[model samples]
Target chain A: MKLEILAALNAEREARRAAVLVTEIATGKQRLVREADLASDPLAETLAERLRMGKSGMAETPAGDVFLTVQAPPVRIVVTGAVHISQALAPMARLLGHDLTIVDPRTAFATPERFPDAPVHAEWPDDVLPKLGVDRYTAFVALTHDPKIDDPGLIHALRSRCFYIGALGSRKTHAKRVERLTAAGFTDKDIARIHAPIGLPIGAISPAEIALSIMGEITAALRLKPASAAQAAA
Target chain B: MLATDNDIMNRAEAWRREGKGVAIATVVETWGSAPRPVGSHLVIDDDGNFLGSVSGGCVEGAVVTEAVDVITSGAPKMLEFGVADETAWKVGLSCGGRIRVYVERVD
Candidate 1:
């Protein structure tokens, strides 16, 4: 690898920016492609597709077969409510390669011992959500079942365009939650982004099972047709 | 295949800086039923010690052999392993596939 390319890649890794290292197979010509560079590359269209999918693969171009090693930042998960589900979720999400932050104003449940190895915060959603830097590569999971705890975080997530937004509740509970979000000034489409009755319909009973379902949904949202590609296809 | 495991790139760079010759073999392309996804890496140090994997095991032996030469010659090379009837029989593959690997020196 060229020193310049390597240095550029290291800098991107430091800043947690998405980047791609494209290696031209025939001549071994290599260059770094940051997310912002996609629109200008000769292979812009294909690169855009690959970036949106967050995948690295061999792309056949007019020049040659170029191998793209996509390096998207690790998905950050802001899990509000350090409840039983979150206790199970923190480690599971970590095992699945996600950075997790547990936010709950209740210090008893959000203690370091309760969620060891994860960054725990005894701060409210409005206080901690901005500090977490929730972005497109982030996922927000609301498990508190309290509007005070979940609503602010969900609104922040919706505004930030985080890849996934999920809230825990029953169908009726979700309906009321929907009314609250609507009244709070979120559009219908924005309110629809929340995966109310959070997690998949897996008939999950235990906290661990519920956590597994949430992780599955989060992964699906991250890997399978991120909203940009879906909108492009639409 | 949805995730990259055991980051081999950083290990390769560190090994080279530590005064050991290192080569990295990466899966550049795959066809048919390949075991590993594209961009998977296997880092081989001068002593034939390797970390990470391009294939589960089916093609590591061949890729390592190429990586050794890349380390020795300081020249990168691309390797192609395709599913022939004999190769499928030898590797005990229930399916057929093709893999293209690029082996290059760390420095």
Candidate 2:
């Protein structure tokens, strides 16, 4: 029984998935809790409530004994340009355990020779992006600086609910791009989703500095607390 | 008995027991002009161990001292050192930033 429990814990950790083991420690009623959906998991629901209340340690359970283990998955970064900034950004993103992919229709730019260790896709955005299936866990960046390449990618990214959609450009260029997007029927709200002039206002001049600013902005976007929720929490 | 810290230690210990060498690095706190934030950690093993950060390079000597003790005794410790200390100037942290780092041997 102990070996079985250990094995389950190991498997969950290996998969990088969260699990809760509900056991009646006093009564020795041990039941492994696995729910298809997190919301439906009673043990997880209870544990989350307890955590929110800042409570820990053994808790009485109607069942037997229960322990919750959570393993967070690594983040993913999908760069839609094989530009110079991407050459620097990809390595840093990889160090942070972000699975990165570089897509560009320009085969010369997207070749592995340019991005030695990255996954390169030498295909058009419309052809390549849908197969990748961007998700909420994914961060998409349109760094091509050319609307012909960046626009279709941004449209795809915005439609798929990616967590971050960043486009590299000047303020004037972005304004012009927005006009084009609006003409194409994207609502203001959809346009607002983009992080144009993508990086932080760090006055970055070089490609590496620009990459750093973009990374910093992406990190902030990921970690920043929602302003609307502060009032609600207060 | 913080569950998060305990869990992290347990995992490190398990790796050590399986022939993996472990070193724990802690961030005590940050004052000014620190590269890594407070509470950032770098863990290293026998081959130059690292996990978290103490201060970019300013107070690494003090952190290494605690780390060596942890490797020998398998005990945890809270080490505090900052620019206010006399030695901080020698470590190149005289820039007015201070940090406290806690190093432990989880294995």
Best by lDDT: 1
User: Residue A59 deviation, candidate 1, in Å?
Assistant: 3.2
Error of 1 at B53 (Å): 2.8
What tens digits encode model 1's per-residue C-alpha lDDT throughout B1-107?
22334245566666777888888788888889988888788889888888887777877877777788888998889888776565344432234888888987766
Report the C-alpha lDDT of model 2 over A3-67, residue by residue, as the tens digit.
35535544654453444444343433444454334466666668555323322234555665343
For residue A167, what is the lDDT in candidate 2? Answer: 94
lDDT of 2 by residue, B4-102 (tens): 332443445555666765665656456677666543555556656444344666667667656766777765565655454554355546667766555
Which parts of model 1 have CA positions greater than 4 angstroms off? A39-42, A227-234, B1-6, B84-94
Per-candidate TM-scores read 0.87, 0.60
| Cα lDDT computed for each candidate against the true fold | 0.81, 0.65
lDDT digits (tens) for residues A1-234 of candidate 1: 654565566567657688888888887788898988778988888887787777789889888788898877777899999999999998887677678899999988889999885999999999989977887788899999898998888888888868788999999999999898889898898887888789988999999999999998988887676665323442
Q: Pick the candidate with the highest DockQ.
A: 1
